[model samples]
Target: MDHLADSQRVLTIGEGDGRFVAELVRRFPHIEVDCLEGSSAMIARARARLPSAAKVNFYHVDALNWEYPVEIYDAVVTCFFLDCFSDKTLREWLPRSINCSKPAGKWMVAEFREGVGGMERLRSRFWLRVMYLFFNWTTGLEAKQLPNWQGLLDELGYGCFEKSETSNAMIYSSVWQRWENARKTDGFNP
Candidate 1:
């Protein structure tokens, strides 16, 4: 969360149970945060984790239908959240979500990814498939595979400037910033 220390305002989409938000507020007490979560039970659990004095606002609403404020946040975060949806959903949702941030705002994402090559790739793909199957069977999740997040981010005019990955490259966390001259597309206005 060091990358987010300088942010004055942040938005977290699908911030499940608020573990990351709690840590973020602990480390950067000065940053104000807004959490958008769809589940009431998850929101209640998350609310219970933070002290009453924490600077957080919880919005219990479906993320896909929520009205995002324009140019309001300094950073937008998604941790293990975006992977729950299909690429078609992400293409329609991500732009609207990112548009809530300022023109130069940062987008931080933490999620599972397929490895680059060799046994790592094989192992990652195996685990990802298992995860998809399990989640689909248990929760009726629609996504069957990992989306091309890198390509989607590129198309949306964001560039990854910082990243870290596990040894197997099955999981990754990345920080991205929109290009200075990037055009706002997909019906989202700057």
Candidate 2:
């Protein structure tokens, strides 16, 4: 969130209960936000969390069906959200997500990652399996394993500018930026 302190327009996908959104609004009162979530209940909860004066547009729509337009946002965020979809779904959604950002826009992501090896890998896998089972039953999430979002981000012209990990690499939060020298289109000036 600190990386985006200067952003004037942000888009958050699956903003969940809106805790981050609320905090972002408080931290950067000048920014406008487009908050997208699939569940109306979650949307309502998120909206309630925001300050009454914050400028946020909440959209209750599936990310897959969102009409992503080019050069629309200064930053895009997804926290514990992309992991819900299968790799194929991510392949389809990621490009759309990046397409919404202006050239060199920031993309922030927070999600669990499969551990590298040893006991940590075993423990991480166990917890992830449990999560998959629970969310599959309770929320109908489709993915059984984490997708290679980093690779896709690279393929789509994003470069990791900052990254942090926890739980022995079982989880990670990263901020990637679309290349500053990326071709400009339709008056995009990043």
Best by lDDT: 1
* Residue 35, model 2, lDDT: 89
Q: TM per model?
A: 0.92, 0.90
Cand. 2 Cα-lDDT: 0.85
Clashing pairs in 2: none
Predicted structure 1: lDDT: 0.87
Please identify model 1 stretches exceeding 4 Å from their true place: 181-190
Question: Using alpha carbons, what is the TM-score of model 1?
Answer: 0.92
Measured with C-alpha atoms, the lDDT of residue 49 in candidate 2 is 88
Q: Which lDDT values do the candidates have, in the order given? A: 0.87, 0.85
Report the error of model 2 at residue 83, Å.
0.4
lDDT of 1 by residue, 91-164 (tens): 99888777898988888999999888898889999999999999999999878998877788889888777788
How well is each residue in 7-94 modelled by candidate 2, as lDDT tens digits?
Answer: 9899999898999999999999999999889889898889888888999999888888888878988999999988988879889888
Determine which window of 10 residues in candidate 2 has minimal summed lDDT: 181-190
Error of 2 at 4 (Å): 0.6
